[model samples]
Target: MNLTRPAGAVLLALALASVPVTAARATTAADEVNYVALGDSYASGTGAGNYSDALCTRSRNAYPALWAAANDPASFSFVACGGAKIPDVLDDQVSALDEDTTLVSLSIGGNDSGFASTMLSCQYSTLSACERALATAGEYVVNELPGELDGLYATVRAEAPDADVVVIGYPHLYKEGGLCLGGLSSAKRTAVNKGSDLLNETIAERAAAAGFAFADGRPAFAGHEICTGDAWISSSNVHPTAEGHASAYLPAFTAAVAGS
Candidate 1:
């Protein structure tokens, strides 16, 4: 009997040996995460209640706090403030990020685009005023916001070179087809929602350009907009409620972080 391997088997062995095997990268453990939450009122959880501080309106129910509570990360610095703009993040919040930061979550660019003021004008002023405000904000979103976001994102990258940054976006404030009383006209609501869409689109595009993950909250709040009876947005200042933070933002951030 001849002790020899089959020619096909030998060829298969040679082929396998020629292929390179790359090891899968190990994922960071939850306990090893050094997360830094940065940005505006949305990130601080202004309307979510259970305030940890009055100044920034940092809520215990905020998505960052909720994630930190659930994961028990090594360190979590929630520096997001209520009225924070891009400059504020550069001047104040970015200080929290460092080389050891494994995770970063941000919800900025709204104030910079004058979203809050637009909403206010839409709510109190005439439809024409609302339209003008939306138009102005739209211009800012298109012309100015991209560069502002690029600068901020670049700073984040430089500070936390090893971290995974996740940028969270705003949701539509009103259910388009839902019935409602006299808060805002259907046209105003639609315009406001359109503004939200534009803002989210800009943020998502910039986040992707910076090699960061984007967590869109629009889908999460589809049926829970302000006009809907079961609203996730607070009536006070159009910010997310505790339920919104817990249900919409928390899950969105969680999924983005996991995928990142």
Candidate 2:
């Protein structure tokens, strides 16, 4: 799929009503069986990546594992790798997915084109520098991440009509003023984070269009933010920490599958 930036860009905002935990509990045995997972490092749990994959990017503490542990599915296939792009997941993730699959969760497209890297380049550089880079990169990510997400979701649905697909969005990258964010500049961090949120909107839109579940990680993780105590995002404040994983994956999977 061509990943060139597109023309139209819109701020992503959606209101999701939380379903009760009891409501999301698996009713039938089948609901907990035949699970398949796909996505990039975030899905695999980077700083959390020991037994997952050989790639240094995967993590043991990542959300998918957290979800797996919570649900205890009979058959689980987690193909989340580090630095995986939309094309990468589409081409390489099929081996881990199959018709018998009852559920699939993924967090992809972040690395499809080096979004975080581009955002980080502006760190402590200068306001103009950060804005210029983010504007350019945001347009690129907005343009490309959507098409990549659309095609991927379309493919995933075709592969597993019965599966409940959980497309997760990244949480807030920066606190309001980037306060208490480890040691990063609030401005640079906010720009990169805002860019991440833009990409997340695309992911949600695609998930909804495809009859899948979209898990929003922002509000649920508001106070914790990135680097705070009980933080879910890593000390780097970019990737999700163990705390972040708990907030995002388990609850999301549970709620999403509850309706599934």
Candidate 3:
């Protein structure tokens, strides 16, 4: 028996046969991640130490650097800077992103909310003064920060349309019930931690609204908060230590990316 095939069917079959299967195997952004790390001090690994660049304080021990080293993605751009505010990120870092970018990780807004000043007041001044600073920072976080984050997140999404953006949140600085000889008082520590929670919540909400993944660093640094003997955060600076970046932020970021 002889089979007769339509001319159109035969032509289509030949055309399909001529195409290489390997051509269809061209890698996507996911298959070959072109990651761009952006944000402020936390993202730059300030207290983690072993800084590679003096200006940005871009530490090799930072979570972004560590992840890049471990995963060895197709490309990694570490543009996070110490003391980077929302405006700074918009002006400087967002330029690193483009259509080819697949992954992005950042922790921002703390600087914008005057977190450093608030912490300084809490550390050096009276409890009343600390409360005042906390109130100011909380007010900014609630009132001003959401709009800034929305603008920044919109810019990021516009630049890296296909990237899996992960917005990392700050960890609570102190272990509430833990012992400390003569640093911040328990009440001060509690207030600061609550402030940190509020900041994280604000960031999380904005990230969610922008369709970005939010990585909560609080749980990751749970037992390792500043007052804990085995603290992962630096007591002096209230920034994550090397171990904190390695164990806490790194895992939090990795998990967020995986889930994303």
After superposition, the stretches of candidate 1 with alpha carbons farther than 4 Å from their true spots are 1-31
Writing each residue's lDDT as its tens digit, candidate 3 over 37-81 gives 999999999988899988998999999999999999999999999
RMSD of each: 6.8, 17.3, 3.1
Give the number of the best model, judged by lDDT: 3
lDDT, candidates in the order shown? 0.92, 0.70, 0.93
Q: Write the per-residue lDDT of candidate 2 for residues 161-234, one digit (tens) a residue.
A: 77778887777755657366345577666776787678777778878888888887776677776546566666
Misplaced by over 4 Å in model 2 are: 1-32, 178-182, 227-229
Clashing pairs in 1: none
Best by TM-score: 3
Sorted on TM-score, best first, the list reads 3, 1, 2
List candidate 3 segments past 4 Å from native.
1-24, 28-30
Measured against the true structure, the TM-scores of the candidates, in listed sequence, are 0.88, 0.80, 0.91
State how far residue 211 of model 1 sits from its true place (Å).
Answer: 0.4
Q: Name the candidate, 1 or 2, with the larger lDDT value.
A: 1
